[model samples]
Target: MSERILALMGPTASGKSSLAERLAERFDGELISVDSVLVYRGLSIGAAKPDYPHHLVHLRDPVDPYTAADFARDAKRCMKEIIARGRRPILVGGSMLYFRALIHGLDDIPSIDPAIRTAIENEAREVGWPALHRELAQVDPASAAQLHPNHSQRICRALEVYRGTGVPLSSWQLGEAISQADQFECIALCTEPRAALHRRIECRLDGMFAEGLIDEVRALMARGDCHSDLPAIRAVGYRQVWAYLQGEVDLPTCREKALVATRQLAKRQLTWLRSWPDLTWMNTDDAGRLIQVDKTAIEPVKTDENNEIAAVEPVWADRIESLMRNF
Candidate 1:
């Protein structure tokens, strides 16, 4: 039997975790989170992580850095262990970059040079990230489009990659993939309907504030070990709330900014989902529409001897549509 995993992906506030929990129960699978922020130990309410026990959640201190490469390594190990235990591994979250890293593998860029990083940060401190973004547009427009101007960490990394090696980070990805497509035998599940998703975003952000998102940020700050410049602090909701705590913005402005940031995050996630090569787009965001992970969808992904996914009969596609449709 070929190894198979279920990848449940969606934008922030799209009910992915809830659906994943139910799918895990139905399919007898273990859960693996694909989130950048969920790795941070103290980032709970602001990150909007599910209030349940899960692997890969709260794995690191907020001050520590956890790269996509790190996540891919950990995720692959967890998946193998889960499969060995006779259960499927259901990977879940909105971190699309992590998904891509796991599927396609990371590019061979030079390791982080502190001198280069400090130079980029010094430049950012002077003219801000938009100037650096314009510079990236000149060199690597593809990466710039995938990133937001306010995404200082990625923006800095892209620039560092270019400056450190004189090669574009996006260009490196265009080369060969390190992993075979059929090795994971995973099918991505996502949803659409822009207006409905936006509504959910608004409601979720409002609920986050009501649930003491500010207090959570405050607690992390009170720890004194964590700082606003850490990668975890730059996460959508926490960034805005931290600014409010720093007196950089008022409460109303913070709430407004946080909602906008989350909406933008959702939009980027949607872009990634639509671009995914092996995605099965679910028409509805309502988990009730498809209550379980139907096993039939994974059984027919025939692969050639070279381990590439082979073209199967149309019946397989139809079966997937039937089993995964939001009816």
Candidate 2:
């Protein structure tokens, strides 16, 4: 078998980092974080960044842009460096687009000018993203067809590519150049019952509020460069906290909105995981222990009417260790 690149992916507050740390230590692996927001500095508390060292965290200033392409390039380089030091590469985080870009490759689209992007954003602010998405539908119906009307970032990028290169984003996508899929030896998804996951999410959000997540955002705002439009500032918890700081909402309302947004984020993450190919599902309990599950068994357990998962026999550490040992 080819060398393995083990991946641990899950939704926010899913205990991925703790598990990745343990596995990395056990397997002599180096972790490369796959989170989009964790790349920026000053995003630590709200991003739920782990204290344990992981490549790709805190690498960029909050005001700077980091895209999936940048992540793919940096992650591949980090993997090579770790391998050169005779360590295993383990990817960990919930950023599905980064995973997809690394595993399946991205389109060889021309770089859109900053001015074009700025103009698009300006227009979005004026007429709203749905209006711009409608404009995109007129220009590149294929790309527009796949994007949600509210997916402003993607809509902007698709329109920018169309305007900058005079070719539709979907057309450029046809020339996608590389894939690292064959190198993956294991792709594990950490999940639990929907109710269990929601409980985890709520508990984590409350903890973040207690842990000065708002203060962390204030520190970023104090920099005077970070703004609502920046990706780092636009992150889940940070965005809601920023709104509260801006006096647009009360603390209680902000908390409620943040919790709802987080749950929605988790839902989207699970939606991506469900359609994901070659995933080994792992169920995590309240105590944060992991047990491997059959992929066929995951869907039914998640949709159970009671929102409670029946106890399944746990193979836990030994099974996982054996699987990686075989790899």
Candidate 3:
């Protein structure tokens, strides 16, 4: 029989790590981080990576540039290894793209012609992103609808795809029939009231600052390994912090911008998660029930003579209590 793969997914500051850690203990599972920013080695403060070992897969490494493909490959490898060792694999984090790529194969859209890319980029530079978006809307409204008005890179790519392949970007994506794993189950935990989530986001940002987030970004910048355009650097906190370091904005303005960005990111995450079919949605207010249900689900297969899996129950209960206390 195929081993079970459980995904514990939610937005930033949504207590996903705590929940996943507890779940891991209960189920004898190893965690594979699905976060994009956490893949960078020195980005701990802003990424919020836990100090404890949890079978991390795509965590920060200074020497490597981690991509979605890299994550997918490593995640699959980790799952196999964990299963081989008689443990379940628990996928956790807020990276929607990574999750999507894992469950649904990334579309193999035709590569852009260099000339077309240059043409679209030149148009964006000369006419502005709005004009480029309008051009995409004229050619591929479906693709345009999936992108934000300010998402210049995707908009440019969509336009380039149309110009180069004579096919709409949406059509290519539709043509790719990706299959999901048969043994996988997804649980999406959205801790709400919306007001509470907003407050949590604000508090988390303040805590990040207190944790020396600025110095972390300064160190990253010092290495000259990343820039504003790189997807990793454009993560919610890093972009705003980078702007402040570049003198494009004051410190207070940067903090406010980061907070706003995190809120927006959380909203987007909620929206994306809500759209997932067959996802078991759980409210954070009823976390104990969720943990109980998860624990019950995994109890039957557990059979270690030393009762290692059984030993983790009290730990799970304690972490849940601590998390609820903070909540």
The whole-model lDDT of each prediction reads: 0.75, 0.78, 0.71
Best candidate according to TM-score:
1
Q: What digit string (tens of lDDT, one per residue) describes model 2 on residues 71-172?
A: 989998998888889888889999987887777677767667899999998998899999999999999997887666877888998999999999998777
Q: List the residue pairs that clash in candidate 2.
A: none
The clash numbers for all candidates, in the given order, read: 0, 0, 4
Each candidate's TM vs. the true structure?
0.84, 0.84, 0.80
Segments in model 3 whose C-alpha atoms lie over 4 Å from true places: 54-65, 138-142, 174-181, 286-327
**Model 3 pairs in collision:** 39-60, 40-60, 41-60, 41-61
Query: How much is the lDDT of residue 324 in candidate 1?
Result: 28
Q: Which candidate is the best by lDDT?
A: 2
RMSD of each: 6.4, 4.4, 9.3
Per-residue lDDT of candidate 1, residues 1-327 (tens digit): 245456777777766777678766755668999999999988888888786557899999887789888998899888878878878777888888888788777776667678999999999999999999989999999999888787888899999999988889888766344345445434444333467677777887888889989999999999988887898998899999999999999999998999888888887886666566766544334332443344433222243585433533222344433432321
Comparing candidate 1 with candidate 3, which one achieves the higher lDDT? 1
